[model samples]
Target chain A: MENKTENNKMTDEERLELAAKLDKELDEFINSLPKKKYEDGWPEDRWEEEMEKHPFFMTKTPEPGAELHPLYEGLQKLKYDPEENEPEDLATSYKEDGNFNFKYKNYRLAILSYTEGIKAKCGNPDIEATLYNNRSAAHYFLGDYRSSLKDCEFALKMKPTHEKALSRAAQCCYECKKFDLAVEYCDKVLDIQKTHKSIIDLRRKCIQSLKLKERNDRKKNQEEKKKMSEEETFFEEILRCGVTIEGGLGGLSLEKLEPCFPQLAAHRVHFDENKHLVWPVVFLYPEYKIMDYIQEFNETQTFEEQLLQVFECSPEWDREKKYSPDSLNIYFENPKKKLGTVKLCDTLGMVLALKDYVVKGGTPSFILLVRNSPAENRFLENY
Target chain B: MDWKPRHEERSGTLPQPSQETVKNLKELLKFLQLGARLDLKALALESLLAMTGSEDGIKSVLCVEEILVSLVGLLEDNSEPIAKDSAACLINLSADIHGPTYLLNLSKNYCPPLQSSPDTIVKECLKHIFNKESNIADECCMILSNLSRDEHSVGLMFDLLKETQYGFDDIINIFTKVDYNTRGAKLNYLGPWLSNMTQDQRVREYILDPEKCVIQRLLPYTEYKESIVRRGGIIGTLRNCCFEVLSNQWLLSEEVDILPRLLLPLAGNEEFDDEDNDKLPLELQYLPEDKMREPDPDIRKMLIEAITQLCTEKQNRKYIRDKNAYVILRELHTWEKDAAVLTACENLVDILIRTEDEIGCDNLKEVDIPEDIAEKFQKLDV
Candidate 1:
């Protein structure tokens, strides 16, 4: 009964006190529940939601000890570091693979690696030079000299005085026997390091080899000259000694004479048989034995002379003399005595002898001799 | 060197059967007949070869058309000796006016033997024939020398000298006997052979050989009065050996320098003007309008064929490139109606199709051309 008036209508101070005690009780209760801890120390689905909302937050923020955000590191460091994110990892992997394969003899794989590294780096000249030089060596070993040379050229382009690259390039040029290029590369190498033995020695070898070749070539040419001269002399003797088969006067014209009567022109004599024309007396006496005469004939000398020698020949002499009294001798007016003439038959036997003689370097002068005619008007007359 | 001792002894012991020694009915018939049978082919070949070494053999070989036919056939034959014997015979024949016809026949059919013919003798014979008349035997020797490019054929090329009793100086006779005015038939068939051989591997080998005397023979030819033959021979020889020599570094460094020695003669040849003659000799001068210039159409037609042969030969074409191919092409483009120059123009066009588009007619500045003709040079755009 007393409760009716007790707290129901308590004063405002009593209500306030009660409310404060309730607030304190509520705060204590809220604080008292076991603290909710993330098992992985992150909010539930926090990363996933953050990635979807503003992915830049995770990417742009630097992880502890990551100098710059790993993703945002400049291209140069990304290419060098081994433990970066996907893109950076890819570049590092290529660089590592290139060096590894290059150390091995797997040049093709190394080239692939280096090329990938270059791609990853996007045309850095240092990387390009490495790729080119390594590939050049690979190509050189593969006997692809031209390709090797090309790569060396590229490598040289990047670092002009790269001695190893230059030496290798020169070696490739040498292997391809591109002496000119080899000398050029060697010169470049010498410019970098003036007394490199291998390079100097190679240049020396090239020079010596060139000199030896020149000397040997000169000697060979000399011998060739000697042989050619001998042949010329042999042909000359054939023209000189071979018999001249008389042809019809119409054939005596300059044109016909050149081909048919080569003997009239006195073609040069062969080296072996130039002895006969010491005197015209040799022609009249015919004292030289057939063998001796044959020795002067060079059958292989020319086609016409050989033709004459292979065919048969018969000699006919016509003598006519005209005594003009004013001329020295009026004693005998023999028509035959005036002009001395001899005719050669176109038979096979005589021609062969003449041919054989000419081939063997014999010059039978009677075929070419023309003298002692009163008017010097005698000419070959045969059809 | 001593490989044929037994054959030499046999030859000495036997009464050597003369070409005319056919006393039996069979022998007499073969001798009397112009053609030789299969049985007589050997005898005829022997006679022909014998004639090559001496003047007698030349006459003996010339008398037999049968031998000539056999030789021509042999030039095409798989049998090596067939060509070799024929070439030997041709060398003898070429020295005579009548012999040139036979040489021409052989030149028409000559080609290097197929690999099927293992005998190098045949290849050597082919080389000899080419050496005799490379100037005119362009196709014949080119085909044969191309065949002789193999390692085996190259090894046996010295057979050209089997009958070479004379030395290098003998080469002088090839030009010395005949004046520039001479025509119709060649006095020395070797002119063509030498010209042709210059394009051959065997000839190159001979030129490069330390022991052989072929270079000496070539020396006289270089100074020859007939500039065409001289230049043709020298340039052809250099062109043929270029690949081989250039491939060998040792060789390239040393011997490669001598190309100018040969090229100089060609330069001189281009300088030679036909002095005081309205008509240049077909063999001695380079006349673009020669065929059309002839009074007779038939002769002009023949000249056309000859000029075509002179320019289109593979070696010749290469020389043209080296000497003044582009300039000549330009000149030919502007010049009149010579069948040869026209065909050459077609060839030049084909060549342009393969040449790099960047290399234009401007490269021709190295060669000398008349200013009038120079204006006509084409810049072939490819």
Candidate 2:
């Protein structure tokens, strides 16, 4: 009985050994197939689908002791779970769709999808902000400024600190001509960030426009008042000085004095042909015959004549010189003694002072002395 | 009365102090601040530590910060004897809470220009201050190893590395020294350092030798008692060898096997990307063409996977292309049995098909006599 049992056991062992050897051979044969030979005639898509069905990316084969379900199975469970189908999930799905639509330049679809996301997750700050921010951009693209502003305000309210939301809100306000609100939003952005040049420029433009409006209003009011006042005051000052000053110390009529002053403007002395101001006053006011007066004054009978003579000695008293607003020459003259002592601060100022004293102020014999010009070389040359 | 022995009389002794404790403390402080006057300082410090014990001395030193400051000053002394004495005193006192203060003081005072001190004695003193039973040895080794390789300390450093305890890390750290006194001194001293090293030691030596010295000695040290040491030794050796092999023309062709040993540890960790390492494992596998047909599946699998990974990684594909890896991969594909192996083989086939013939893709089809696999090849829509 023992010998029979031994023989049976030996045969059993041999059969098992044979099976193992064959398994090894089969494995080798399958491996030996050339890489291309197996892939050549096989439907590549079908193989890929089959591989996906079996979870090819998994690190381990399905076994009894494995800790978790296969990745495909887990993903499926997650897909159908009630919790996964909640508002947050809906929001996420809609958001992804919106992003995809946005990428494809489907702004209309993107707006719809983002709106759905906002509706599903009303309490979710990020979703709410993103939805409104995105819809604002869509409405902006569509040229619906009112709707864009509405959506942007919603976004800003949901997340008060949202940068894109605030940016969009500002843009919407700007588009709608709500310049104050636009500037306010921009100021908010600037408060959060001091270096946002675009926001700063926008705010600056808004403020400038408001200021321009105020300035235009002020100008309009002043112009109207001035127009009425001009009409009311016309007859008094206009008729009073129409081509004439009624009173004069020389007993000269305005028409005659106009020509007379031209002669008086030139010729500093009575036929004193060597004097520096003689030709300037003579040629400009040839009829005044101030040369006789100047010659009498040169005789120096009064203190005023002596003072006027001091100005006559200066070369800058040559009245033919042109004066500009910035002329460096200045001449100081004391009119208390009715004497002109011309002192040229510079050539320009000195000439201007002399012209003003005699022509404009009608001051006779004023003392004018050059404040800073060199000593009167013209007198020395004549001497 | 006549019982006085000649030996006892000849061995003279100093009289014991009334305050034995104070006497010991004085001697210990002197020893701690051992100066050029070696015997006095050593005897004094040794006597004090022996009398006081480390706890009392350490406690006293910690309680008295001023004493520690003085000890630091002594350690930093210019005279070798003085510095060495001070280092001993600090080392003894280092057991105290004030010990860290000594290290802090040393770091603060000696870190900069003094770190570059020319005197060998001061450098050694600094090094000794760092060496303690505590893990401060790591830091000490670091400072010493860095200091020793300095231009002024290179001669002294070579003498230091001759000590057996200077391990592989030390050599690597020391090799980073740029301002070593002489290139010849570096090379000349390296040969002797490498001569007596075990196989593992040789592995580390190869890493340090920029100019590959006689490398045969390193082969034995590779046979280490611990697998970690062996593996680590391999990694270190190969990391250094790869630099020598690829860029260094002076490196030997026989040392090509070094690259294979480098890739051995990489098999377990997927994060160990050869792309970052520049196809080192693939280069290693290619080094031995006959190994492809070796019966060991594990060896074959490692080689194929590593090469496939190398081929797949975009950064390393060029090297793979350059080495004509596709042909061997095609050869492996003909015999590969495992499913993952088949995938790798197919990838190798795909890479070869895409690669230009300059990379030796022409030989891709010549190795096979299998029909079904060949037919799969024909069906590929490249």
Candidate 3:
């Protein structure tokens, strides 16, 4: 072909004839040189049988129904002499493979290769730390920052002065939002070499992030405390009132009722005994009441007089046609008065009468007058 | 005996009704007073309809209190022509801003002889819109369309639309009919009517079907050639629909294919000539060049908004990516001059790119960043 090209473009037919003549000559040369004796002039089948007896062919073909060797399955390779290779040399080879994989961005494969290098236990702390540090990088690129931190810790254990491991441990902690740990790791690196500007920058960043995180946590704690206090005040009011309101059977303790009224935080409530009858007892002056007249109480009439005044103004008087007793009027005026002309009703009876009056289409004011002993009265006066 | 105004010949000049003409118009109004013959009253209303056809004529007739009161009274006439002619006069009268308010006030004050309440006069006008009589229906729809311009009457008409169930189906039937002139008139009225009604959320529930497929029926009208009002109405309804996430998803879904339909209005005059144009839906394929370049920036802004809202959903973001929305939006962002539309295009592009980044489809080659930007970055590095 070179002669044809160099001879200033030979005719197409001459080139074809020369190519055919050379092909026949080449065939004759190949046929005459290849006839070799097989030591016994073996037939084709006999040649195959002889080839199978060779170690190369014997290993290539497995016997039928024979158990397969472990090396022939999966990735296992046959070892010529396993004891010849030192642990350190084997680990170095694995580390090189890991570095090659890492350069190509095959981070998962790099991680596996580095793990294999670490498991080899080469007894060289330098190589072990290098393996751990390399695997931490692979983990960092894969966004497994926690695992990266763990590998960095292992690297530091093997060689405490490993600068790359310390810097990477800080980076992983920072990525993981573990800012305090990040700052500590950066401080370790900075302490070893004061002029490490990158580590110092990282420490500054971590401190700034830590401060931001602390501020956020403080704000969150304050909001949570405000919510808790509001909830507590709501329950305390309900307990102090000892009355059931909109949330069913509200006289239950805070523990039982908190689940029902989760959103009803610190809202003032007024109880109407006729409206909610679940409570066994009703108090005339529940502490939860707003008590707008507390400062005026000393200048006004006594508590008994106030109670009689409310009873006289009750609409139940008009509906039931039950007039206030003449002796009740005298009780309102005198300091020492008892129920002589009127039959004294208990709290439940008075509540039922008020309810009955409301049911009869009359609005009534309810005031349960409790005749406390002198000691209880003196105790209430302090409030 | 002959109170009709003589037909004056002024050869191509608008009738500036003389004092004599106003006097004769007043005499015709007296004939339409209570207990007048139905035919005579219908005739008077038709004459008044013709007289009120000009701005000056409407001004002259509006000054005559008896004629305005009688025209509203004629709305409740037993004869359809009288009622329709009365509504037609009111519709023409309502072309001016004060006209609908004037008619609305008349409807409030004047009780027709047949209907006890004055408000029923407006209701009767709406009732005649659904009448099988085309003239009556056309005139009533036109009147209500004008009345709907006022915010108060729009609420009242929206309530009437709900009460009559004369909703999307009626509007679509009128719009899609073969008669172009009638469709134009009806859509001119129905568009603003529908656009105003969409402001009320309750009316929107009636506008959107239970299966949420009503937008599909409304999307085609966005391309109607004869009426820009109809297109505005459809785009306005779509803008309102995007206020909810479910409707936004429906708009972006393969079922509605709203992205391409929305692009129709925003596309420039260039014919879609790309080799890959076959990938577009058949409705979007080979559309008449400049078929949907809305001259109004407001309508164009609404189209951009509908697309932006659709991009809010993750699935819709993926759909927008598959449909090559980013390419169209990039072109629009460069070509668009309106500040609001440009902002919307930028926002939509940012959302699409951000979503693509989140999904790791960060093939920067697919995005069309200018080469000069890279050159600028190189200069900065140096």
Candidate 4:
């Protein structure tokens, strides 16, 4: 046996030309292969539905007529000469090659060898199933669940009672997050051998996950229902208080949509223990670029009453005797981009009901400025 | 033409059932409630299928409220035909807002009788869509596609996807694989279904999450030739996602490089000189002679609109212009026949032809459309 190989003397252009020629020859070889009759044919789905099933590795078939690999091979002697090695011999050698790589933990190389063994099309069903099952183990090590699952399916198709293929399929389904499919595979395995402990453990894990899923769904359903009904209550109360929904803002596409009234997303709209609608209204003082997030404004309270409560401490931002109940003017943006100023005498519900009012971003927003001050002039200029 | 929702192509009208119809549906729905008489089950499903055909009829059926329990229960029937009709009837009911909302609100009340069965309509549908061997899986995917269309229904679906591992990541895996399902379902509707779900800002954020490769995987499917339904759905989804102005730079940049995809469909076989070709994206340069524009007018309009949305930001507009997008649009203008697509193309071209200096603004979205007279002054350069 010769241990050493001869070095290539081919030029770059020669190599390129040879590559192109080989590609053309390969296509010709594939084209010349006989059509498969589906009923008696080996698995097409297993080979990814390619007509030339298992076109993994093969010897070059000599092209026609020319003493060399030949051109216009369709011309004279385009004989389809395949490899001379018996399929059984090639398959067994490749199986040993795959097992050698698997022992060395070279899973990628192992996968390649197992694939070639499967492609050899040996007549023995047991050898074919082993090849498929071994390839599936390599894919599992590589964390390719979908590929591993496909290989398992092919192995099972070859040998229905194969324990490894069925168990591997169950584990692959679990990793793919198809817990129900995992359970089905587990059941199939248990049907064959009831004393399989690891298989039983996998089944138990899958069952627990499914139960957790149902429990999570039930909790989620109840929470969503509670939120919907609660929002429905809050929205209905505001509507009853004469606060015109939409207010011509057109920000909302529909009129009847339960006001988003999203709690924690922005302001909270809820009912107080007194059965009054309490809203967390936001007040913008544009001059200072500060906002007073009024945590609780009972809709029944008047602007004067709330302002008195808001300014009771002579708040931090008001350095110039500004923003008192007597010295403030409130305005909101109307749909036409004009300012509709409100009188201090107006209540929160009346202010909300004003024709210019719009509940934007599930919250009620208002602009507050000092009367006849420089800041007031600046606010109006932007407005 | 700018935004063609799937509601138009869907069967039947809005539900508006009256008291008398509600009473009849309540009584009729009892067939499945009684359990396991195949003949009665068939008769009831057929009658329910008829009622699901009209909005008035479905509204009447929904009045019973527990109708979800009865229909989804039959999904596990030993009889395939009866189970199939059960799935079909559920699909019709879930097609519109009224049905999906009712299911979302009260699904717990209609819990399945089987201890091991999925607890709610959505959880059951999600499970079935992933489990391909089930005969009713395709119908389950359809039910999900319709369920995710409305904003209200999307909240619960989005939440479930987030809490469980079967999030958009898993959903996209099933969607992109042609053979993910053993039943030969292409899952084309997942495209529109996902597009519809993007109406929620959270969904848009999830797909567009810079951390994840979700949107990048979808970019190649703009050229998927198998199903126009799938192609159009992805294009619509991309357009909806482009509405997020903050993501414009990323979408146009090399990471996603969405401009080439949007322009590729509008491009044809028209050859450009080397100078023009050099400025274009590598994919758009020197296209083969047999290259053709997208055949569907609505899809053409969507591609143009997506590019237009990307142009709202100034840097993205500059990036698009430097790519020599005009040559493709120039060729498309001559070849295009659809009026609406042509207008969309013109709008995009109008922005590209003018320099940023001439447009006199950093962001087009902020350049308030002039008060009638100012537009005449701005058009003076043209």
Candidate 2 per-residue C-alpha lDDT over A132-250 given as tens digits, one digit per residue, 9 for 90 to 100 = 88888788788888898898888888888887768777877887878889887986786577567788667766755654554445445545555656533432332233212223334
Runs of candidate 3 exceeding 4 Å displacement: A1-383, B1-69, B73-85, B92-110, B113-122, B162-188, B268-298, B313-315, B332-382
True C-alpha contacts between chains kept, each model in order: 0.00, 0.00, 0.00, 0.00
Clashes of each: 78, 64, 0, 6
Number of the predicted model whose lDDT against the real structure is largest: 4
Q: Which stretches of candidate 2 lie over 4 Å from their true place?
A: A1-84, A216-383, B1-382
Question: Estimated TM-score per prediction?
Answer: 0.24, 0.22, 0.36, 0.48
Model 3, residue A179: C-alpha shift (Å): 64
Indicate the DockQ of the complex predicted as candidate 3: 0.00
TM-score head-to-head 2 vs 4, winner: 4
> B128-237, model 3: which lDDT tens digit per residue?
55554445666666666666664555566565556554565666555545453442235356666666666656656665554533565677677777777777877877
Give per-residue CA lDDT, model 1, range B204-290, as digits (tens).
565566443344334434434444543444434443443342222322232233322332222211222324111221122332221
The local distance difference test score of model 1 is: 0.43
Clashing pairs in 4: A64-A77, B14-B55, B15-B55, B15-B56, B16-B55, B16-B56
DockQ of 2: 0.00
DockQ for candidate 1:
0.01
Clashing pairs in 3: none
3 or 4, greater by TM-score: 4
Candidate 4 — which residues are off by over 4 angstroms? A1-383, B1-20, B111-118, B160-165, B369-382
C-alpha local distance difference test of each model: 0.43, 0.44, 0.60, 0.76
Per-candidate RMSD, Å: 35.3, 35.5, 32.7, 36.0
